[model samples]
Target: MTSSDRSPILPASAAAPRSDSEVERLHDLILSSLDDDQADEVVSIPLAGKSTIADYLVIATGRSTRHVASMANKLAQKIKSETGQLVRIEGLATADWVLIDAGDVIVHLFRAEVRSFYNLERMWGFGDNTDSTN
Candidate 1:
């Protein structure tokens, strides 16, 4: 199905048409950066109409706490440099899980074990089978 066929999941007042290219660019940057950092089980969930939090939700697992922290830092810097938008990051102190809130995207970086335990993908309704790693 094409993007046009999908309806916005959010209410009219909460949802407004955003520049598709900008969102797509940010999504692409997040995915590519995660891959470059060797993130495991990378998954992208399209949340345009499904949620108002962000246009997209990206979840990935890092090999360890250090990896998770490193990925989070790099991703934030990358987004800032590319879009000139400062991203908000949380949970970095523990490095077990890091949440990066970019304007158009919300990224979660977690250690493999922590990721499995939380299973945000399942909570968000995207099962393990949904892999958008193209």
Candidate 2:
């Protein structure tokens, strides 16, 4: 099914109009944050009906490991300050690929080489049509 055809996997109550707007708000926040962080080849994949993990999957690349970690830290902090949600982060030590789980929006920050190797966008059916803001 197309990404837009998939229904969000949020709780029944969260399927209401209010929750939909919240999800959209979170998604927009994530995209803007990534852009502001200067992430390259940013791509957002709607996983609503396709995945139970989150409503949206955002993938982006950093110039290096430090950049990846910095982006993750900043994004996590932004999510917390904006939504009052404590985001879960992983792989910060290596900084090769950091994942931030912010309820409705999940973000993946990766080093250029690492991102190319994993190619989350292609795996998630985003193809090569990445929305690069670089």
Clashes of each: 1, 0
Candidate 1 — what's its lDDT? Answer: 0.82
Q: Write the per-residue lDDT of candidate 1 for residues 44-102, one digit (tens) a residue.
A: 88877778778888999989899999999998888879876777788999999998877
Best by lDDT: 1
- Name model 2 segments beyond 4 Å from true: 1-18, 126-134
Quick one: best TM-score, which candidate? 1
Give the lDDT of residue 105 in candidate 2.
77
lDDT of 2 by residue, 41-100 (tens): 887878877777778788899999988989999888887798766677889999999988
Candidate 1: where are CA atoms >4 Å away?
A: 1-18, 126-129
Candidate 1 pairs with clashing backbones: 9-49
